[model samples]
Target: MELLFLGTGAGMPTKERNVTSIALTMYEERGSFWMFDCGEGTQHQVLKSPLRLSKLEKLFVTHLHGDHIFGLPGLLSSRSNQGGTASLTLYGPPGIKEYIRTSMQLSQSRMNYELNIIEIQEGIVFEDEQVSVSARMLDHRIDSYGYRIEEKPKLGTLLTEKLNGLGIRPGPLFGMLKRGMDVTLEDGTRIIAADVVGPPVPGRTIVILGDTRPSEGSAALAKRADVLVHEATFAQELSDLAKEYYHSTTKEAAQTAVEAEVKALILTHISGRYAQDGAQLLEEEARSLFPNAYVAHDFWSYEIPVKSREEI
Candidate 1:
């Protein structure tokens, strides 16, 4: 999975950054993309990336702020215009449905595909064979939420040598065995999948938070995360201002990551006042607390590296 930052600036668009939108592309895993937030001009930003609106399957909005969701209507309308017919589901806090519905109605926008809007609560919101998503309320100006996306543990790799030793050549039976199914051979010998298979491969966890102050819920949601995407809207010196605005500072975000024991921390939703140099300073400040902390810029993409069993 890869994270594509379409817009990373906080509150408003700047020359260096747009707003807050991120695309979690899972083309290899699911052949689809999931978007988080859709700030203004997000469609224009997508045009500059390799992501396709047609391949977008899910959207998770953090809050109803203008900078976080103003581009929903335009992006939805453009998706239909571009002949996107796949079903899309949106998950967000309460009032998200009303906002999307009202915007589409006011603009006379008609979607060609099914659009599902879910008003989420603080718990598990979505689960499938591959992934499970949970939401937790965050300390923001509004009812913002942080999302914990946990990939399901994958089946252990097939022990080809073990199977070969048992006179079972590669075939459809091997596929079933890899899925943890027992098989009976022609010689009347029963093969137990668990006995031959390796340990289950641990899944990766990612926590993406909305605009918020550092809170216990944030750390809980980010516990053992492979990547913790937190908002850092202010530097260390302006931490008081950050708390006053219900946003996090670089130090606060780093501390959250450290407390959560996340492997990496990516700071987004940067304030527009921070230019390239200022953004670098924010990264440096965060790195002082957490060595793996980074400040994300618009259009920057990050690949979450998988961990081996030993590392986990």
Candidate 2:
């Protein structure tokens, strides 16, 4: 899986950055992508990336802030023009539905595909065989949320040599065995899947938080995450201002990552007060607390490496 940062600035668009929007691309795993927070001009940003609006399957809004959701109507309408006919689901806080509906109505835009808007609560919001997503309330000016995306554990690789020794050649039975199913051979020999299969491969966990102060909910949702994406809207010197605005500082974001034991931390939603050079300072401050912390910029992409048993 890969993360594509479309816009990383906080509150407003700057010459160096736009606003808050991220694309989590799972083309290899699910042949689709999911977006978080479509800020103004987000469609324009997506046009500049390798992502396809037609392949977008879901959009998760953190809150109803104008900077976080102003581009929703335009993006949704343009998706139809770009031949996005597949069903799309949007998850967000309560006022999201009204905002999208009113915007589309006022603009007289019609969608060709089915759009599902789900108002989320603090719990497991979506689950399938491959992945599960949960949401937790955050301490922000509004009812902001943080999302935890957990991939399901996969079955171990099939022991081809061991199976061959047992007279089980590669065939339909091999597929069954890999799926943890027992099979009976032509000679009436039964093969137990557990006896031949290796240990289960652990899945990856990612946590993305909205604009907020450092809270316990952020740490809970980010526990042991492979990647934690948190907001750092202020530097260490302006921590008091950050807290007053209900936003997090570089130090606070690093503290959250450390408390959650995350493998890596990517700080986003940077305040416009910090230009490119100032942004580097924020990263340096965060790295002082958590060595793996990084400051994300617009158009930057990061691939979350798969963890093996030995690495864990």
Candidate 3:
């Protein structure tokens, strides 16, 4: 899995960054990508990245903020025009259904594909065989939410050498062993999967939060996540302003990462007041508290590699 920042700026767009949108690309696993938020001009950002609009499978909106949902209608409309025929599911707050329906109705937009919108509440918002996504209410101006995306554990690698040593050449027996099944060979040899297979490789966990102040919900959602995407709308000096605006400061964001014991912290939703150099300062401030903190810029991408058997 990989994360690509479509826009990282807060509230409004700047020359260096746009508003808040994030893309979690799982091309290898699902042959598609999922978006976290769709800020204004987000479709433009996607055009510049390696992402394909046709491969967009789901969109999870954190709140009803304009910066978070302004690009929703545009992106959805364009997806229909861009060879995106597959059904798309959107998860958002209570007002999202009305907002999208009204926008489409007023614009007279016609889609060639199925559009599924779910007005979400706290708990597991989405779940399938491969992964599960849960949400919790966060402390923001509105009823904002933070999402926890956990990938199900994967089966371990097949012990080809061990199988070969047991006179089990590559065949249906190998396939059965890989599927964690015990099989009796043609020679009446009973082979146990656990004796030869390695331990199960642990899956990765990612936590993405919308605009919010430091709260237990954020920490709980982010607990031991491989990556925590938190908004740092202000620097340490403007912490009071951050609180007043129902946003988080660099220090506050970093502290949450530390408290949650996340492996990495990615700070986004930067205010435009921070010019190129100022944004670097925000990253530095976050790193002071959490060593693995990084500031995401527009089009920036990070890989969350799968855990190996040794790591597990």
Candidate 4:
């Protein structure tokens, strides 16, 4: 899986960055991509990237802030116009349904595909055989949430030597065994999948948080994540301003990464006041507290590698 930052700026758009929109592209894993937030001009950003509206299967909105969701209507409308006939699932906090519904109604927009909106609560928001997502309320000005996405453990490799010894060659039976299913030979010999398979490969975990001040909720949701994406709207020197605005500073974002013991920390939602040099300062400040901290810019992408069993 990979995270593509479409707009990393906080509140408003700037020459360097747009607002807060992220795309989690899983083309190899699921043949689809999931979006996080959809700030103004987000479709324009997508036009610049390799992502396609037809592959947008899911969208998880953090909050109802203008900077976080203003481009939803336009993006949704464009998806239908661009031949996206597949159903789209959206998960977000309460009032999201009303906002999208009203926007579509006011604009007289009609979508050819089904739009499923789920107003989320503080718990498991989505789950399937491949992945599970849980949400927790963060300390934002509004009811913001942080999501923990955990990919399910993958099946281990099938021991070919062991199977070969049992008079089994690579075929449909091997596929079944690789999937952790027991298979019986034509001669009635039973083969146990676990005995001939390696240990399960550990999955990866990612935590993505919305705009918020430093809080336990952020740390809790980010526990031991492969990567933690947190908002750092200001530098350490602007701690007072960050608190007043209910946003996080570089130091606070780094502290959460440390507290959660995440492998890497990516700071986003940067304020426009921070120019190129100023933004570098924020990264330096975060690295002081957490060496793996990185300040994400617009269109920057991060790859989250799947962990091996030994890594776990």
Candidate 5:
């Protein structure tokens, strides 16, 4: 799985960056993409990337701020025109469903595919055999939420040498063995998959948050995350301004990562006030404390390494 930033600017759009939107490329895992906060021009942002519009199956909106949701109507309209045939599911805090429905109705926007909207309260928002997502309210101006996504451990890999040594002769049995099934040899011998299979591969977790100040829930939601995408709307030098606006500073963003014990931290929702020339300073301030911290930009992508069961 991979993360692709569609827009990373905070507050408003600028010539250099658009508003807040992120796409989790999960086609390899589930044959679709999951979007986070469809900001203005998000569909336009997707057009600039290699993403297939038809593969957008899920959306998680953090809050109902204009910068976070202005693109929903346009994106829905475009999906209809672009022939999106798959049903879509959306999850967010309360009011998201009504907001989308009202926006589409007033704008006369039409959708060709089925849309499933979910207003999350707390606890597990989504769960399947392979993955589960939890939501918790964060300290934002509105009823905002942060999502913690955990991918379940994968089954053990098939040990070819063990199977070959037992003369198990691979065929459709390999599939069964990979699924942790036992097989019986033709010579009246029995081989169990657990006895020969490797260990379970550990899962990966990721946390993404919307606009908020430095809060304990933010750190809790991102605990031990492989990647934490957070908002750093201002430099550390502007801590006062950040607090005034109820946004985080570079130091606060990195500190959140450190406190959460995240493997990597990506700072996004940047304020356009920092000109292009000031980009390095913005990144340096965060990396100074958290060496693994990365400054996010529009279209930036990252792949979280997944180890085989044997390696894990």
Candidate 6:
């Protein structure tokens, strides 16, 4: 799995950054892509990348703010035009259904593919065989939510050496052992899967916070997260302004990462007030509190490498 940031600015689009959108690339896990916060002109941003709206299986909207969801109608309509024939599911707050339904009705846009709109609540927003998603309320002007995505664990690797020692060659027998089945050879010797496989590899956890102030909810949402995407709309010098706006400061965002013990933190939703040099200064401030804090920019992507149990 990997995270591809389509837009990473706050409130409005800047020449240096767009609004707020991130694509969770699940090409390997789900054979599709999932997105969070389709900010304004998000479709335009996707057009510049390899990700396709047709392959966009799931969308998780953090809030109903314009910068977070103004691009829904455009993206959904363009998906059909892009020759996408697959069904799509969108998860968001209560107003998401009304917004999409009304917008589509007003625009007289009909889709060729199935469109499933889910009014998101605090519990399990999405769950399938491969991945599960949950959300929590955040401190914002409206009913904002923070999302937590957890991928399911994969089965352990088959030990070819162990199998070869038992006179079993790699073939359909390896497949059977990997599927947790016992196999009996022509010589009446039985081989159990446990004896020929290594330990199961753990999956990845990704946490994304919408606009919000400091809260335990952010910490809980980030527990053991491999990558945490948090909003840092203001630098430490603007702590009072950040609190007034119900947004987190650089220090507050970093502390949440430290408290949650996340492996890394990507600070997004930056204020345009921070120019190129300010980006470096803001990154430095966040990292001083938490070494893993990283300032996010538009179109930045990172992959989660698969590692063995010992490597982790």
What TM-score against the true fold does each predicted structure earn? 0.98, 0.98, 0.98, 0.98, 0.97, 0.97
Per-candidate local distance difference test = 0.93, 0.94, 0.93, 0.94, 0.89, 0.91
Kindly give the stretch of ten consecutive residues in candidate 6 with the minimal lDDT sum.
303-312
**Candidates' RMSD to native:** 0.9, 1.0, 1.0, 1.0, 1.4, 1.1
lDDT of 6 by residue, 160-242 (tens): 98899889997999999998999999999989999998888877889999999988778889998888999999999999999
User: Please, what are the lDDT tens digits per residue for candidate 2 over residues 1-312?
Assistant: 999999999989999999999999999989999999999999999999999999999999988888999989999999999989999999999989999999999989999999999999999999999999999999999999999999888788888889989988888998998899998988999999988888788888989999999898998999999999999999989989999999999999999999889999999999999996998899999999999999999999989888796644
Shift in Å, residue 90, candidate 4: 1.0
TM-score of 1: 0.98
Better of 3 and 5 by TM-score: 3
lDDT for each residue of candidate 5 in 1-312, tens digit (9 for 90 to 100): 999999999878999889999998888789888999999999999899999778888899999999999999899889877779899899988899899999999988888899999999879999999899998888878988889989999877788998888776678888888888887877868878898788889888989998899997798899889899999999998999999888999989999999888899998999998768666788899999899988888999998878555534
Model 3 per-residue lDDT tens digits across residues 1-312: 999999999998989998999999998889999999999999999899888899999999999999999999999999998999999999999999999999999999999999999999999999998899999999998999999999998888888898888877888888888889999877888899998787888889999999999998999999999999999999999989999999999999999999999999999999999986998899999999999999999889989978776755
lDDT of 4 by residue, 1-312 (tens): 999999999999999999999999989889999999999999999999999999999999999999999999999999998789999999999999999999999999999999999999999999999999999999988999999999999889888998888889999998998888898888988889999999988889989999999988998999999999999999989899999999999999999899889999999999999987988899999999999999999889999988978985
- Measured by TM-score, how close is model 4 to the native structure? 0.98
Off by over 4 Å in 1: none
User: What local lDDT score does residue 153 receive in model 4, on the 0 to 100 scale?
Assistant: 90
Range of the 10 consecutive residues with the lowest summed lDDT in candidate 1: 303-312
For residue 102, give model 2's deviation from the true position in Å. Answer: 0.8
Error of 5 at 65 (Å): 0.5
Q: Ten residues in a row with the worst lDDT in model 2?
A: 303-312
